[model samples]
Target: MRAAIHDERGVAAIEFGIMIPILSLMVVSVTDIGLAVFRKMQVEDAAQAGAQYAIIHGFDASGISSAVTSATNSTAVTASPGPVKFYGCPTGTGVSVVSAGTVCTGGAQAGTYATVSAQATYYTLINYQIIAVAYTYNAQSTTRLQ
Candidate 1:
């Protein structure tokens, strides 16, 4: 008769089988979170960029749109909510900007401040080829560059 010693050969396969699922979940979760953060930052940058362009250019909606378009360089951006009409400012009080026309019309002064909200819709790619789950993301940022 012979003797049996500790080999631990099959133990590795068992451990790996247990760890794969956990590892995959962690990786996908991280990916989802990272993508969300990235999308949020992108929208914020676009909004603030549009606002800056508006304050400097003044009453030019297309220019602001172009600025954000240049910032995002994507078709997902919608600049229609602005230039956001300004209704109360240059009177030592803050400006109240609304949406109706292509630019601020009535309540804005020469040095009045304005703000605009930018939105970006993100479609996450999750498939059996990529990961085996589904996800979607929508990010928004209200940038005050004025």
Candidate 2:
């Protein structure tokens, strides 16, 4: 009876069996998070690509949208809210919209700017009580054309 109690045989197997589920769950969770982050980056890159297209090719709504969608391998990405053109003065952080003829506080005249946006939906492999299974990611880029 004492020998049976002290027996260490199969202990490693028992421990491994107990930890398998936990390790598997961790790996899956990490994979899901990594995929979500990568998709978000793709969305952001798509927006930037659209803006670049606008800067080089000028702002054609359909053209910008096409550029955004084609910028990424994922078909789920799209140009959402469409592209917009406005007059704005360049600021330290970003462009500040103003009248076409208006001069900015820094003495610079307002210039034409275009904004492009991209969006995508990400679905997780598993749903958790603390977080939703699906997430929406959006990104936007603005560039001065003139």
Predicted model with the maximum lDDT: 2
Q: Which sections of candidate 2 miss by over 4 Å?
A: none
Over the stretch 41-131, how does candidate 1's per-residue lDDT look in tens digits? 7777887788777766775667877777678766666554665534432324444454433244454433334555566666554453664
Instruction: Report lDDT (CA) for all predictions.
Output: 0.60, 0.95
Error of 1 at 134 (Å): 9.1
Estimate the TM-score of every prediction.
Answer: 0.64, 0.94
lDDT of 2 by residue, 24-86 (tens): 999999999999999999999999999999999998999999999999999999999799999
Give Cα distance to truth, residue 116, candidate 2, Å: 0.5
How does model 2 score by TM-score?
Answer: 0.94
Best by TM-score: 2
* Candidate 2, pairs of clashing residues: none
